[model samples]
Target: MKILFLDQSGKPGGAELCLIDIAKPYRDRALVGLFADGPFKTLLQQNQISVEVLTTQSIQVKKSSSFLQGLKSLRQIIPLIIKVVKRAKGYDLIYANTQKALVIGAIASFFARRPLVYHLHDILSKEHFSQTNRRIAINLANYFASLVIANSQASQTAFVQAGGRANITTVVYNGFEPKIYQTCESDVRQLQQELGLIGKFVIGHFSRLAPWKGQHILIDALAKCPQQVTVILVGDALFGEQDYVQQLHRQVTALGLKNRVNFLGFRADVPQLMAACDLVAHTSTFAEPFGRVIVEAMLCGTPVVATKAGGAMELIEPGINGFLVQPGDFQELAQVITTCLHERHKTATMAHNARKIASQHFDVKIINQQISQLLSSKFN
Candidate 1:
């Protein structure tokens, strides 16, 4: 079936990366209509996915935007909406990959008379989104979306709690190609040596540097960790979170952790970096809709410790496959890190279990089949 996928990001976030896998199966018949042009567009091109920059203008609405601000942005995006409506008519279904996409896709779907699927990636809660944004998202999905593909049970639950239709929402975890994460020993050693992490117990944190992402929490926990423990932060700030990025640098300095911390910025070699690390940490201060990094780490056969909330709780069973710590608990996180450091054999076993489970459940082929079945059943 012909499908039109809409995303608003100019950079590759978890949701945008997930969209790449979802669109791959329908590459010949699908078009990824991006609201802005940047690295994500380039990534689509590299993947051989049909993509187009639908609008040159930016959507300035933030998750905490006021209703007036949203309306102003909506006015600016009218032309984009018209453009999407014209394009939507040529597709069997319109799949919205982000919130801003949902806003435009909802209106376009109504005007174009096409079924719309809203992929819910974020937890629609007060911690993550403003009440106005949550209301807009839920109302739009309820009224215009034929189906809502939530990234996790946490995301699905938050939508229903915010008055979304439960019947319309279903959980679908982000998929990854397990083989992509299997780095050769020589490559892992080379990466470790290149990063000057040789003989250090390396910890990797792979998310955009944001306050809610809790990069500072990791830094704080790092200060308490053994001197042999080192951290490599793998992502850069995507939004206007430069201030938070600066704050993290200052925190690392004040805590005297400059030598132990490495800001690698945004690199395309995520799987290699993950495989080189001895442990991965997901230290989000708030409830994450889905911990994509956690699954990626698992697929890389690296032991992980994630904040114990939201979808993280679904992915990890403490001491079984991986470990979990309470959100924002630096002491708990530090302790977990120390435990993993001292008990290498135990963590290694857990990592093996994690890789096996992740390979079985979150493989890209399996996830794409699930999505295809859902789309076929709903839109056929």
Candidate 2:
């Protein structure tokens, strides 16, 4: 079946990564539309997925006051909507990969009489978006979209709380790009040398440095872990939260963790980084819709320690595939890290189990199959 997938991002974040699965079923028959083209376009092209860049315009919206910026983004995306609606006639379905994409593609679906599936990656809760934005999302979902595919239960619950139709929403976890991580003894030593993980145990927190993502909390936990343990923070600051990044540096210095913690900002080779790590960490104080890092870590045969809140609980089974600590409980977090570091054999076993579980559940094939079925049922 022919599909037109739309993602508004130019960067390869969790949303764009998840879009890879959304477009997997239609690599040969589908065309992915992007708002602003960048590395993500190259990634889709590399995978033999057809991609089109509609708008070269990019607006950097800081989280401080995004309402004004949101209006600007919507205004700039008008031409994109027109182009998509004109092109969407041939597609069997419109799979919108993000909130803005949903707003655009939902209209396109209406124009083309194709079923619209809004892939809800971001939670509609007040924590992530403003009250005005949340209301708009609810209204749009209620009026335009045929179905909603939430990446996490928390996201689905948030949508329902925002008055979205519950029966129309399906919770599909954001999958890992496991092919990048599945390897037998990759040369992770390069990461070890680059990040200085030779003699120390590394606890990795790999996500964009956003306020809700909680990189500072991971640093707070690192202060309690053994001195031999190091924290490797991966990813760059998003929406210009440079003040938070500066504060973190001060906190690390105050805690005498300057030497113990390393900021490897935005590495493209994440699988190698995960493989070199002793353990992966998910420390988002707020509910992380889904921790792609947790699954990527698991896919690389590495044990993970994540908070029990949100989608982490859904993916991780405490004491089985990985350990789950209470959200923001540094004592519990410290204890789990200590346990994993001390018991090499047990951690190794959990890592093995993690790989087995991730391969079964989070593979791209499973996602492609589900999307194909969803589109088939709707179109048939």
Candidate 3:
């Protein structure tokens, strides 16, 4: 079936990365319509996927935007909606990959007379979204969407709690190709040596530097860990969170962890970096819809310690596959890291278990088949 996948990001976030795997099967018959142009479009092109930047103007509405603010921003996107409606006519379904994309795609689906699929990637909680934004998203999806594919049970639950239609939603975890994370030993050794991480018990944090993403929390936990335990932060600030990046640096300085912490700032060699790390940490201050880094680290056969909330609880089995700590609790996070550091054999065993489980449940092939079945059911 022909699909028109719409995403609003110019950079590759978790949702954009997930979209790449989901749209791969439909590459020959699908188009990824991005709302802005940047590295994301280039990444899609590199993969030989059909992609087009549908708009250059940024969407002005924020999660904290008021009703009047939202209405004003709606005026700005009218041309974008018209453009999407025109382009969507050739596709069988309009698949929206992000919240802003859903708004435009929902309206375009109506004008184009195509079924709409909204992929719910974020938790619709007060912590993450304003009430005005939440209501707008839910009302639009309820009225226009044919199906809502949530990234995890946590995401689905958040939607239902926010008065979304439970019947129209289905939980679908993000998928990964395990092979992509299998780094050569020489490569891992080289990366570790280059980064001066040799012999250090490295904890890798792999999300964009945002306040809610809790990069500072990891830094706080790092300060509490043993001197041998160091951290490598692997992403840059996106969505105007440069202040948070500055704050993290100050926090590191205040804690006197200048030598123990390294800010890599958005490198393309994620799997290789993850492979080189002894353990990975996911320390979101708020609930994560799904922890993509957690799963990716698992695929790289690295032990993970994630904040105990949202989809992280679903991915980790405490004391079995991986460990989970209370959200924002630096003490608990540090203790978990210490345990993994001291118990080498046990941590290795858990890493092996995590890899096995991640391969079995979140393999790209299995997830693509599930999405294909869903699309087939819709068409049939």
Q: Total clashing residue pairs per candidate?
A: 0, 0, 0
Q: Per-prediction TM-score, please?
A: 0.98, 0.92, 0.98
Candidate 1 lDDT by residue in tens digits, 68-168 = 98888866699999999999999999999999999999999999999999999999999888999999999999999999999999999999999999999
lDDT of 2 by residue, 185-236 (tens): 6378866876678999998888887666777888888898888999889987
Q: Which stretches of candidate 3 lie over 4 Å from their true place?
A: none
Model 3, C-alpha of 259: deviation from truth (Å) = 0.6
The model with the greater TM-score, 2 or 3, is 3
- Give the Cα error of residue 59 in candidate 2, in Å: 5.6
* Top candidate by lDDT: 1
RMSD of 1: 1.0
Q: Which 10-residue span in candidate 3 carries the lowest summed lDDT?
A: 67-76
Q: What is the alpha-carbon lDDT of model 1 when measured against the actual structure?
A: 0.94
Shift in Å, residue 270, candidate 1: 1.3
Superposed on all Cα atoms, model 3 deviates from the true structure by an RMSD in Å of 0.9
- What are the lDDT figures for the candidates, one per model? 0.94, 0.83, 0.93
Kindly report which residue pairs in candidate 3 clash with one another: none
Across 103-174, the per-residue lDDT of candidate 3 in tens digits comes to 999999999999999999999999888999999899999999989999999999999999999999999999
